[model samples]
Target: MVDVFFNTWDNNRINNSRPIDTNDPTYVIVHGYQSTGGNPGNNFTPQAWMSEMAQNIRDLEGNDANILVVDWQDGANTLNYFAAADRVDEVGVEVADYLLGQGVNPANTTLIGHSLGAHIMGEAGEELRERRGEVDRLIGLDPAGPEFEGGWFSRPNSTDYRLDPSDADRVVAFHTSSTLGYDDPLADLDLYINWDDLLQPGASTFVGNHGYAHTLYNDLLDGFGFAQSNGTTLSLSTINGNTAGSVFVDTFTV
Candidate 1:
């Protein structure tokens, strides 16, 4: 059975206003870590962000795509790396089952994750590929955390199914960060789309330290088959003493 957190036409108020088709491709966005006091940092809420993305897609695509926001409170706390990793796979399966139930072909769905959310998407995508043979695309938006690095929370490259050399057609990762260690893992991805090449000239600092911005979200919206054109690609510079070795934007057509 699939666990569904939200449906667009479920409520009479929303359904009566606009009847949405459930057959559209679904996009799931997962959020990253919270701050020290167990509060959602930077006012970042997974559901809110997902809703915004959904609205943007509908406005741009004219198709009512289902956008699901996954929230795992237990995984948010510190020192629970194993549990967090497990939750990612669980959420992925749940989302996949939900999409299947809605009559949306698994091949049409896309999963997008940011920061630790990227790790979740990786695990989830692997599970979906192995079990359901669904989930056509998995986009990693600056997937950074202790798990990607060498630590007790580390997730080895072997666990990232999307990075497999043989399955090159389905996976794409975008790295956009001025901070070195934050976006270094993007280098190992199969199809890497660097934001350093996608930003407009003189548009240096992105809004948050590690959160979605207009530029990043616009790129995602465009990539997911909504908008015709998104943001620009700017040149990235390499700073010394950082984990990022070289920064360049290259598109992979598969």
Candidate 2:
């Protein structure tokens, strides 16, 4: 079943609208590491991130498009990477099954993930593709963590075995400040967006570090726009409010 964690405002407003309708595609957002509960270092509580993302999606797509923010109990632990990835796949299947039960077409659903969450999305897409058809879309936002560069981390290319070009009609991958080479494995995909080469003259060159400025968030918003417009790949500077960087978009038809 699709488990929905709505914002408190939505809960209190008590609208007559159904949280998710099968006729319309829904978005399931998965957050990155330290996004869960119980820590001062955490940017926002998992519930809060869910609420915020749901609100954003509602603002962009209105009430008809459903948004589900997932939370697993072990979301905060560092050693639970494998478990978390597995959970993402399980949750994806659950969401798809729920949508099917509600009469929603599998082709209409989309999965969006950031950082480690993106790896989770990849894993989920693979699992879902095995049972059902591919998901409508999978958006990866700067999807690499510390482990991704090292031998210990499970690379998306190696771990997510189902993101082949033949599986999905569209697969869009975006890299803002990814330390890993983002273009190699995905060059054959339908679309690839990158901004790593656009780093400012004096920008930090820390190895395996790409979390500079607010590039991550801006790239995500722009990526959403690009996906919706079916526009050509972009190579523009000035994303959000950051300067001295550029964005690139490339599309290939399979």
Candidate 3:
């Protein structure tokens, strides 16, 4: 099961009963594999980034927006990657039901997920579309590639199996690590940061590289600025249209 935590504009964690205002935008953040949600920290160092990103959205949207953090640590923190991957769709349904019960408007909601959580959000968005049509935006922060893209498991070519353009009205993704993260263009607008190599600059390991997507995204939420890619200026603040292609961001030059 997935646990969805709510946050007020004051950044205070609240219970699920607080009615969400459908007029304002809501941001839901989901963490990836082998991680728990909270502040102190977890074995996965970047797990805490969820709270930071949620708070950043809270600060950006003020009292008008709703910020949600999803905890699927029970399903995620496991030695068997395949077992954990199998739980994505189940968790996604749980999340989608929670939002539906809360009366969250899909047109005013954005689902953001990292690694395996990205695919989970994809399933959630798909569930919402099946019931309510579509969501406003869906952002995948370095979606997991191992099983979803084809490895020791059966690779699914359908959008139903992973994050894709049909998941939301506007699907966007950021790729920072090609080794652990999905490198293919799955979103309507795919942004590849430091695409030339597997390891991102300043990242000593693949894990660190995988983390850059959320960290950089958190910064982008706080107006860290934009980058020029494929002759197009890209940033979170200016996401628009069905841009069906990949944009490479050379972090060193940007």
Residue 53 in candidate 1 has what lDDT?
57
Which candidate tops TM-score? 3
Query: What lDDT, from 0 to 1, does candidate 2 have?
Result: 0.47
Candidate 2's C-alpha runs over 4 A off are 1-18, 37-53, 79-103, 145-167, 180-183, 187-254
> 1-254 in candidate 1: lDDT tens per residue?
21224234222112223433556766666655541111234222334554555566566545556555555544555576545544555655565555555565556666666656666666666655665565666656556544444555555445452223222125555555434124444433422234545333234445253443324554445553221133423221111012232334433211
Error of 3 at 15 (Å): 6.7
- Residue 3 CA error for candidate 3 (Å)? 5.9
Model 2 residue pairs with clashes: 233-249, 234-249
Of 1 and 3, the candidate ranking higher by TM-score: 3
lDDT of 3 at 4: 36
lDDT of each: 0.47, 0.47, 0.79
Q: Which candidate has the highest lDDT of all?
A: 3
Q: What tens-digit string does per-residue lDDT give for candidate 3 at 1-254?
A: 54433333236443444557777788888888887654223332235687688778887777888777777777787999888888889888988888898788988899999999899999999999999869999999999987888756566546788899899999998899888888789998888887887577678999999999888888778777655645655555545455667877776655
**What TM-score number comes out for model 3?**
0.88
Regions of model 1 farther than 4 Å from truth: 1-22, 35-48, 77-86, 101-103, 151-157, 160-168, 177-207, 212-215, 219-254
lDDT of 2 by residue, 85-104 (tens): 44555554554455555555
